[model samples]
Target: MTLDDLFSAAREAMAKTHSPYSKFPVGAAILTEDGRVFTGANIEVVSFPEGWCAETTALGHYVMGGGGRITDICVTAERLDECTPCGGCRQRLAEFAPPDARVHLTDQAGITKTITMVDLLPLGFKTEILST
Candidate 1:
């Protein structure tokens, strides 16, 4: 899928964000290697820690749909340049997306920049990192 399409999906998902607490709505869309796209919005809970991030939610949707090998990802929030994934989300994404997979960050204005998964998490842990 094109970056424009991915960003559009993310924007649409952002409209469904349930961030009553922080009001910091965010959205994410992931493109599978098979050309399928999955989108998700951030959901906040009263418990605070129960809040779910957009990236994680998108990944869950992808997995539930039997998708594999994410080829690209787009994230949108109040500010495009500032919509980078958190450390935990970065690691989670690394589990599914290859190091060379593109990650687009965008907002209402437009796409801010694109970076590879490895650029987001240079030292992501892998199964091989754990010696038997």
Candidate 2:
């Protein structure tokens, strides 16, 4: 799918965010190399620091749908322009996507900047290191 399509999916997911506490709705869309798309929204729980980020939710859907090589990702926030993933989300994304995978940051108007997973987490721990 095109970046625009992915961004649109994220926006739709943002509308479904269950962030009653933070009031900061966020959305994420993942595009697998096989052309499958998965979307998710931020979910907040009563317990502080127990909430999940939009990217984490998207990764959950991607895993349940039979994980594949993630080629691209889109993230957007209802209140922030060009919202990027959080540090934790960056590590989570790096676990599934390659260093070169494109990360599209979007605003209400659509994608505003494109970055790579490596750019988001230059010193991220590689899953390969854990395999041994």
Candidate 3:
């Protein structure tokens, strides 16, 4: 799917965010190489550390659906400037998305920028590390 389409999915998922604590709703949409799309919204718990990021949730949904090889992912939030995935989420994405996979950042004004996952998380830890 196109980046715009993925952004739209992210927006839709954002509407379902259960962030009663922070009220900083976030959403993510992951497009697999096989053309499957999985959307997720941030879920927060009373304990801050227990909260799940939108990207991580989306990745989990994709895996649960038997999807693999993320080709692109879009993230959106009210504050566009802070919509980028966190360090933990970035590492989680690196587990599935290739270095060249597209990472799109979206906001109320629409997509802000599109960069490769490598640009976001250089020197990511991959399976090769475990094999070694």
TM-score of each: 0.92, 0.97, 0.93
Better of 2 and 3 by TM-score: 2
Error of 3 at 36 (Å): 0.6
- 1-132: candidate 3 lDDT, tens digit per residue: 777788899999999999998889999999988899999999999998699999989998998999788889999997556479999999999988899999998768578889999999997777777987
Ranked candidates (lDDT, high to low):
2, 3, 1
> How far is each candidate from the true structure, as Cα RMSD in Å?
1.6, 0.8, 1.3
Candidate 1 deviant stretches above 4 angstroms: 130-132
Supply candidate 3's per-residue lDDT for 126.
78
TM-score of 2: 0.97
Ranking by TM-score: 2, 3, 1
Q: What is the Å distance of residue 115 in model 1 from its true position? A: 0.5
Deviation in Å, model 3, residue 17 alpha carbon = 0.5
lDDT, candidate 2, equals 0.94
List the pairs of residues colliding in candidate 1: none
Q: lDDT scores for all predictions?
A: 0.89, 0.94, 0.89
Q: Ten residues in a row with the worst lDDT in model 3? A: 78-87
Alpha carbon lDDT of residue 82, candidate 1? 53
lDDT tens digits, residue span 67-87, model 1 = 788889999996445589989
Clashing pairs in 3: none
